[model samples]
Target: MSGGVDSAVAAARAVEAGHEVVGVHLALSRAGGTLRTGSRGCCTIEDAMDARRVADRLGIPFYVWDFSERFRDDVIEDFVSEYRAGRTPNPCMRCNERIKFAALLERALELGFDAVCTGHYAILRDGENGLELHRSSEEAKDQSYVLGVLTADQLAHCLFPLGETPSKALVRAEAEARGLAVASKPDSYDICFIPDGDTRGWLAEKVGTAPGEIVDRSGAVVGSHDGAHAFTVGQRKGLRLGVPAPDGKPRFVLEVRPVSNTVVVGPREALAIAELAGARFTWAGTAPDAPHEEFACDVQVRAHADPVPAVAVVRDGELVIRPDEPLHGVAPGQTAVVYAGTRVLGQCTIDRTVSAVPAAV
Candidate 1:
């Protein structure tokens, strides 16, 4: 349980299904006194206490497993290294892939547990081929994009009871009916480790900032910044450029080149991406029968963004995708989740992109 309404309700459903269920709360941070600041952070000491209460009410075993060291080495360090390399990474994806599923699930099976169930809003169905991962009935709460890293073996031992639920309001109501204390608790949002949600400030402390030049498409210096790591693709509000665009239009961050300590700004249209490919890829259940042949699929670049029609293929040991329409503001280190209708196909860490607009010669 996560000390939230969704997880509490999931635990209740699992118990009602007549299976021996145990509530396990992961302690991702070593700071035992860390507490949630409103709904901004999660998995704190307070959340553990709330989870224990729910387990007690359900008359099941509860334990707080310390995965802090592994989390720091995998998720936190990876976040810093990616930013240092001028890439924007999804920490939640890494947490789910490395810490939650890999580390936690491994321990659960060793302890004679059948599966590691959670409150994630996704579905698992027994397809003709094997186990298939699909989106949840609740469109607004669908989280299959983040779970695309799970392999065939992992999905076989997983259970998500809330996949068919129509809405989150119904989950909250069920929790209240069960007398769970966290029925009305606010859902956690931003990154868990960064409680204040100031990623730039936190990154600055880890990777010391240095003054850098901001340039345009034609190699013309436009402005200066304290650090190139502080900016991301498509950001436009805080440029503070000394020179304005020739047409009096606003310029957006197009790229961050950490090697030269430079930030590139340009017209918004330059952000359109024509093609993307990555070597680091994984399939959700099974690899395509003809991996080298092009296949139709929908690609999602962000967690909540709508998927776009695309053609994908595995070539030269990398997964390459070309969207029907140009993708805007996509950056390296971001995950591209491929899907066939509601079923998740796989995902890749975008290593590079080809801009739709040609550079000025």
Candidate 2:
């Protein structure tokens, strides 16, 4: 339940629906700490206790499953590897893909459970093609972007009780009405492992600092940074570049070249991306049947970001998306979620990009 109001309300709704539900709280961290350092992260011991209390209130069996080892191997290591490869990854997506849906769901099904229920704010509906994933009624809290990596089989055995909840405030109100203590628990914002939200500091400890040069488009060294892994595409702040552009305008990080140990900075215009190519594509329901080579769709690159109008095609085992308008700061390792209206088609892990700017003539 994550010891949050949303999940508590979801459990209540499930109970009210007359389904036999059991609460399972995953212990994601191996550390023996009970206190949360900040108001972020979901694996604190206090969170487990809160979840247990809710399960007690609901009069359902509760169990804390130790998934720490798998989580580290799958989510944590993948985060480090992606950064080392100079790609910006969304670890939350990885957690949802590898740990929650794949690992936990498999175990649940083996234990004779029909479906795995969670507090995610997305809807599962029976579409013409069978099962389909859709955005939550609460637009601001929509999490379909992260859950887009789920395949059709995974969606078939999943449930989201709060998908139709009007808003987060209503969820909290429902928890209060049910006398759940977690109704006022603050939502987690930072990455679960990096509770303090010091991503650069945490990465530096793991990836180590390899001093590198920060260069501009002309290959002129503009500044230096502790490591290329510390920066991301389209980043403007923290460059520590004392020199300004020739026109006295600011510059942004256009790329992170880990092999060269270089952070490429340039005019913001250089960050514009025309196309993205991704591997490891997965469809939520059925694959789209395009009469032609390409079809129109909406592509979302980041969580809670607006989906852009685009043309998509599958080529040689990869998904390619061409935005009708140029996008900026699209990084490798980020997910490209495809959608038709509000229905989530599928997602791909971006591996390459095509810049909008033409090469020097």
Candidate 3:
């Protein structure tokens, strides 16, 4: 059950619902697996132990499968390359799709399980046709944005027992009621590979930083930045400019020029973007069949940001998100999850923003 309160509670809920359940935790990285030998969080070895303990408490079978090589190539490598290409990537989404559900689900099937269950704060409801993935009732902790990458088959064999329950606080309360040890464990956020949350420092070690010129849209040099990878689409602080702006306002990161290794600084308004395009189109349903249909929907390009109304259109082999309102700092390599109310429509990887698009959608 991953040794987390949410997953533990999920396993409990499965039993409460009269389903025979077993726990499985993936050792996604051989290296991270070694770390889990000691304690929880990320790839550490202790988390594996904690998972096994939860399984023992539930009187269910549990096992840790090695998925290191696959995780490195699929999640870690993709995370690095996205930044090298000057785009903000969501590694968690990559992990959920490539590692957790896809890899673990396949492994679970090999072990003779009917379906897989996890701590994800989302749901699946079986209709006359098939199962439909829906956002969790606990919207504050909703994580369907990352899980949107799952295909229809994956969703069918997945059970998200925490879907309709209050999260965090209520999950902890359940854990206490069950007398589980991980009830008070802090929630895990940030990229698991970069456990310390130092993306720039980690990138420097892996990608090698080269100091570059910081400039503005006019092609005039404004300042110097540590490296292009060290900046993102809308970062404002830590520019360390020597001169003040003409209007005496703070400067913000507008663009990252990977070709010249330059970071462009400008007013915050310069970050507004109204269009987004990307590849690797994946939809639980409602895509491919109706590829040309236009639907007004909420498009969320990140995990926690609020979705904005947008018209989705596919053209020239990529998904185009034409937002009805301006979206600030829309970056490539991030996922744009479209939603129709609580139901997820589909998802696409952001390639870049278009010019002269409507101010909103």
Can you give the TM-score per candidate against the true fold? 0.98, 0.98, 0.93
TM-score: which candidate is best? 1
**Which ten residues in a row are the worst by lDDT in model 2?**
34-43
lDDT of 1 by residue, 1-361 (tens): 7787788888999999998999999999998679999998899989999999999999999999999999999999999999999999999999999988899999999999999888999999988888999999998999999999898988988889999999999999889899999989999999999999998899999999899999998889999999999999999998999999998998999999999999999999999999999999999997777879999999999999999999999999999999999999999999999999999999999999999999871
Model 1: ten consecutive residues of lowest lDDT: 1-10
Pairs in clash, predicted candidate 1: none
RMSD in Å for model 1: 1.0
The residue-by-residue lDDT of candidate 2 on 1-361, one tens digit each, is 8888878888888899999999999999989974676587777899999999999999999999999999999999999999999999999999999999999999999999988888999998988879989999999999999999999999989989999988999888888889999998899887989988899999999999988899888888989999899999989999999677898888999888999999988888888899998878888888898613798999999997999999999988789999999999898989999999999989999999999996340
Comparing 1 and 2 on lDDT, the stronger one: 1
The residue ranges of model 3 lying beyond 4 angstroms of the native Cα positions read: 32-40, 127-129, 355-361
- Candidate 1, residue 143: how far the Cα is off, in Å: 0.4
TM-score, cand. 3 vs. native:
0.93
Off by over 4 Å in 2: 359-361
